[model samples]
Target: MRAVVFAYHNVGVRCIQVLLARGVDIALVVTHQDNPAETIWFDSVAALCAEHGIAVTTPEDPASAELDQQVRAIAPDFIFSFYYRHMLPVGLLAHARVGAFNMHGSLLPKYRGRVPINWAVLHGEQVTGATLHEMLAKPDAGAIIAQTSVPILPDDTAFQVFGKVVVAAEQTLWNVLPEMLAGRIPRLPNDLSKGSYFGGRKAEDGRIDWQQPAQAIYNLHRAVAPPYPGAFTVLGATTYVIGAARMARRTFADLPAGLAVVDNSIFGVGNDGQAIAIRTLTANGNTVTPEQLQQALIDNPH
Candidate 1:
């Protein structure tokens, strides 16, 4: 198969590597144009492709005349969109005879927009899946070719889940390639009635609200937490940031929820009698102990 890989980030590199391993002859790589200090994992993939004498091109835009002309020249049989930053234009989507596909991190059409894994985790979903689908005009609203579920462990961060999903993605694509090439791939229409959309997250979205019930606020904790942005709260005026967290149960009924300290952990109590322990936190760029955390809260209480 003469394939075109549209990729960005670490997952994008894996997609290239996996396709290469499976003996799929890549026609060329279509990636986001690298910018100053922009560390998207395109370098290694570009280098690998170069070493193997496969073409690599960074399209200035998905619909650019130059890019369109280049792709037409390569005449790829299959197009795989993996973590590509730009939206694929309909003109490009229709280029490949075997069709273009995207690797989505959520079970669509439930979470149909960007960063679906984070949404799934924030909503406390125990199971989140990767969906491989046709690249339609709308994001993640295409017909499904295959999906494989990934576990959301209590200690799991977005980083961990993303890693798991990327690995799952490679396996799913390689397995589906043959059927897809032979024109035997089945596509199930996405139920638009059940789709939900989320926009790009902001810095303010990470601000933690202490007044909320611990469990209710658990999503806020992980939603903007790092390798993302990490949830934060303004203690008086100094913004205190929180990283890893878990919903913990307090056998003692008297303990107050969302409280700053108990047993060297900053905890918040929930209505249903559970305490959320926020471990691994940074305050004003300093790692602090539970006692220090209490002191910070007091000194900066807003």
Candidate 2:
């Protein structure tokens, strides 16, 4: 069956490749333009479309009528969205003869909004998954077609969990494609009351609060660690990007909360009296040791 794909990034690229390999006719590809300033870890959807000689469009407003007309002209039997940034309008969703579906990074009914991976990590969820669901006007508030779980290890960062999500997404799609093409895919309605929604995060949101528990601070560190924005804490005038930390086995409540040199290692005291040993850190945009960081703070007191 012919399909119109609204996709982007690594997951999008993989989904498109799978469709093409299965002999599905890709009528058109709709994706986002890559930002040169942003850190990109995946193949661009536009680039992938170009390599296959397929028509591709990068429209900022997926809900616009201009995009609606474009997809309507294609008259696709199915519209598939994989990691597509914007919410598809009802107009566009209705244009497809069969149905429109999207692959969400988190299990449906939870972590439904933007940056699902980061949210899942921040909340200390042990198991998050990919959900294939019927596309709706609201963001990720869709009926589930199928889902596959991915484990979130205590040590896993957002980027690491993202890798697992990519695999789960692909596997979920592969398992449900045949039913989708046959218009027999099951739809399980979600209880909106039971689900939680999180908005998009910003670089400023990565600021760490030392008053939190060591595990919570560690969660914040991994949630926003590189590929997203690294979690940070200000020491003097310099903002230190915290990449990795561990919950110290011993409590150091006598020490004040926040950055401090303890036994030649950098540790952040938390509200729980436990310490988070800073394992990886950056200061002045350069990787620095605990001693070096403390020296920088000593040299530049604001």
Candidate 3:
């Protein structure tokens, strides 16, 4: 069956690749230009599509008339959106002769908005799933077509969780695509009232608050830690990225919530009276050991 795919990021690329391997003809691929501001370590959907000789279009607007004409010309049997950046307008949603579905990073109804993986880690969710759902006018409010979950370990970084999600997304699509193409896909409504929606996170949002609980701070650290952006804290004029940390059993009662050096290791006292052992620290654009951070703090105690 011929399909029109709107995709970006690693998960998107993988989904497209799997479909191509299954011998599904891709009529058109709509993707986005890479963001120059962020460091990209994931596979590019555009590049992958080009390598397969699929027609790829990078559009700034999902609702543009030019894209409409292209979709109409192809008259695809299926339209799949995998981590595509923008919302598809109702006009395009109707273009699919068979079905239109979207693959989202989080389980249906929860973490509906952008960066669901990071938000799940930040919120300390023990389980999060990848969802493939019916594409509706409202973003991620679509009925669930298929879903598969992965566990979130206590110490799992957002990047690690993201890796699991990528795999989950691919498997979900693989399992459901046959039924979807046959017009036998099931629809389970996502109760909007029971779910939560979160906004997109920025680098500035990674700023850590020492006064929070130790576990909270640790969650923040792993939630935005590298390959995304490191959670940061400022001491004097120096800003340190909290690369790695663990919640300590003991709390320093006398120490105020901020920087605390104990036994040649760096710690941050939380307002909850607990301590977080700062394992690896990034200072002056370099990752350093705890002892090195101790020395830096002593040398520049401003």
| Cα lDDT of model 1 by residue, 142-244, tens digit | 7899887889887676667887888778777878877887779888988878878887767787776655667667776766667676877666656677777
What does the lDDT read for residue 38 in candidate 1? 42
Ranking by TM-score: 2, 3, 1
The clash count for each model shown is 8, 0, 0
Q: Give TM-scores for every candidate, taking all chains together and pairing residue i with residue i.
A: 0.88, 0.95, 0.94
RMSD of each: 2.7, 1.7, 1.8
Q: In model 1, which residue pairs have backbone atoms overlapping below 3 Å? A: 224-230, 235-300, 236-300, 236-301, 236-302, 257-269, 258-268, 258-269
Question: Model 2 TM-score?
Answer: 0.95
When summed lDDT is taken over every stretch of 10 residues in candidate 2, the lowest stretch is: 293-302
| Candidate 1 local lDDT, residue 275 | 62
Instruction: Record all residue pairs in model 3 with backbone atoms less than 3 Å apart, i.e. clashing.
Output: none
Cα-based lDDT for every prediction: 0.76, 0.87, 0.87
1-302 per-residue lDDT for model 3 (tens digits)? 99999999999998998788677899999998988987999999988877878899998998999999999989998899999988899898898988788999999799998999999999999999899988888879989999999999999999999999999999998888777767798999899898889889989999988878878888898899888778898767778888778888677988778777887778877888898888877878787766766676677663
Model 2 per-residue lDDT tens digits across residues 16-87: 888887778999999988888888878888888889999998888888788888888889999999999888
Candidate 3 wrong stretches, greater than 4 Å: 288-302
